[model samples]
Target: MVAVTDKSILGCRYGSSQPQRDTVLYADLYREGRLLLDELVTETYPVEDFAKAADDAHHGRVARGVLVF
Candidate 1:
């Protein structure tokens, strides 16, 4: 077996220089129902059950899992 590598593929870490502005924009979108976080969450678990959520995610059972405080 031979391994092929793609030099075009690159990974970069990203951060927001204006986090506050981004936060406000997202908040507005959420408030308007344009960004439905509930729709993105497949399931939610209490903080104590984080391991369960992690397992579900690893097994491809969950796309998004919310860990509530």
Candidate 2:
């Protein structure tokens, strides 16, 4: 399994700058990285949808997956 640190992931998500926030740069990086994953999946799940998936996974209510990047 690939272990991604929170700091690195957050940096990818929010960028390392203040103004402009480098959003586009980070987004490009994320797309490239995610493309290397086993699955070529992309979806925008709302909070409720995520929570339900987590519940099903564990048979209990739990916070859904949080992708800092």
Candidate 3:
């Protein structure tokens, strides 16, 4: 299972939860999502760079790893 939550000052959404006990896999998925968002912003919102705005969302998950509960 996978879950995401948004609890930031500007309201960002990131993070993922899985039932599996694989830290590497979770990290890979999280990184992929971050890269995707980065690319999306670089291509679409070059001027505003809204993707950076969601850094906190991604950072929170990366810092804590995958949530198993």
**Alpha-carbon RMSD, each predicted model:** 6.6, 12.6, 17.0
The TM-score of predicted model 1 comes to 0.70
Candidate 2 deviant stretches above 4 angstroms: 1-16, 19-21, 34-60, 65-69
For residues 1-69, write the lDDT of model 3, one tens digit per residue. 877677556643444444465567767877878434343332222335445434634665233222222
lDDT of 2 by residue, 1-69 (tens): 987776543335434575465667667767888535324333334565765556554763433343232
lDDT accuracy of residue 69 in candidate 2? 29
lDDT of 1 by residue, 28-69 (tens): 999999988788889999999989999999999999899999
Question: For model 1, what is the C-alpha lDDT against the true structure?
Answer: 0.87
Alpha-carbon lDDT, every model: 0.87, 0.52, 0.45
Q: Give the better candidate number (2 or 3) by lDDT.
A: 2
- Winner on lDDT between 1 and 3 is 1
- Candidate 2 weakest lDDT stretch, 10 residues: 60-69
Best by TM-score: 1
Compared with the true structure, model 3 gives a TM-score of: 0.19
